[model samples]
Target: MLTGIVEIVPGVSLLKGRLSSHETTQMLQAEGLAESDLIPGKYEGILLLKAGAEVHFQDYNQEVLRALTAPNVAANTAASGQHAEGCTLRRPRYFAGDWTGLPCLLEKEGLLATYDVILSAETVYNLDSQRHLLKCIKQGLRPKVGQAWIAAKSYYFGVGGGTASFIQLVDRDGTFEVKAVDVIDDGASNKREILLLSFKA
Candidate 1:
């Protein structure tokens, strides 16, 4: 779970551009307890990790950026003083140098062997990768009881993808049951939400 958070933050930084790494750390530090509220109460699972992963973009890839911000996530986790262990970052399981080709490459090393719960934040903005993301969920998530928690703005203005559109894809396939778990109105341009997904019963 921590690793997933680590993987996600850097991509977000690339998107915002204006927030420095230090500022990002400060924001996480400031949030403190508010951030804890986002975690599930009964989570005892490892997040599927793909180390050395890059966010492929039309212009430039953010592999180096993701690598650099990963350490900060560990620093923040250490600061939070959680007693969790077994967080190891590994090179992505790449097949023919493509991230989307396959995931969980570290499985050969026996890491993140099970993913009962998957969490992603701000990852639905890219329409191009949504299919791959969904494929990851379908392949990695534990059947029946496994769940996915996706957090994003209700609508992303320029990117043309958001929770609504992602949910539309899920609805079109009927593979999972999804619901809006929480909505936070931070007085921002768009409302933030957490959507919970589970395999259909």
Candidate 2:
């Protein structure tokens, strides 16, 4: 099932996704797809899916897919087989400048709930502030159990940050262990990688 999707800002980081309208709702109707076939209460189905409950979706409006499924899949996985307090939904917050101030701000807002997993995509483009970024992650992650998933190009061309540079910082820290989760070479010049970071045991 498709889960969270983000839009990356070049030279900055990732942003929240906005679903666009579909131009061909007519074709779906012509295929004999009826509204009755769709699972009633889109948001209700979304909540159930987030709770690790499977919702057998027949067919529905394509544009509403994300509106109905924006809950973090990581939360679902983290909550799986656990008790009620396992899931979390971290809202999008604007921490535009250096991340050094992020920890205090999040804490002040009473939003400092730590998690078992955190996901970031295409966010390693700033070289100078890498330490601050890691510091913010350290402040909000559960010490031994939390893992950060970073998906990015192996190297960012014009920018100084990428998976290698970020991994170098993480290795130098000695607090976290880095592992190569996956590498995708989509016939592109720079291959993409999924790196997992966990506190060293």
**C-alpha RMSD for every candidate:** 12.0, 13.5
List, residue by residue over 1-201, the lDDT tens digit for candidate 2: 333434222211112333323523443354334542333333322333333332322112432333343343333334434312454433222332236666787688664546566666666866876677788778767778988888888888887888889999999989899988999998956889999999999
- In order, what lDDT does every prediction score? 0.54, 0.57
Model 1 global lDDT (CA atoms, 0 to 1): 0.54
Give the per-residue lDDT of model 1 (tens digit) for 16-125: 12345685455445523233222221111112332222211110122222333343333433322232244444433222222364455534534232567767777687
Cα-based TM-score, every candidate: 0.55, 0.54
Worst 10 residues of 1 by lDDT: 52-61
Candidate 2 — which pairs collide?
A: none
Model 2 TM-score is 0.54
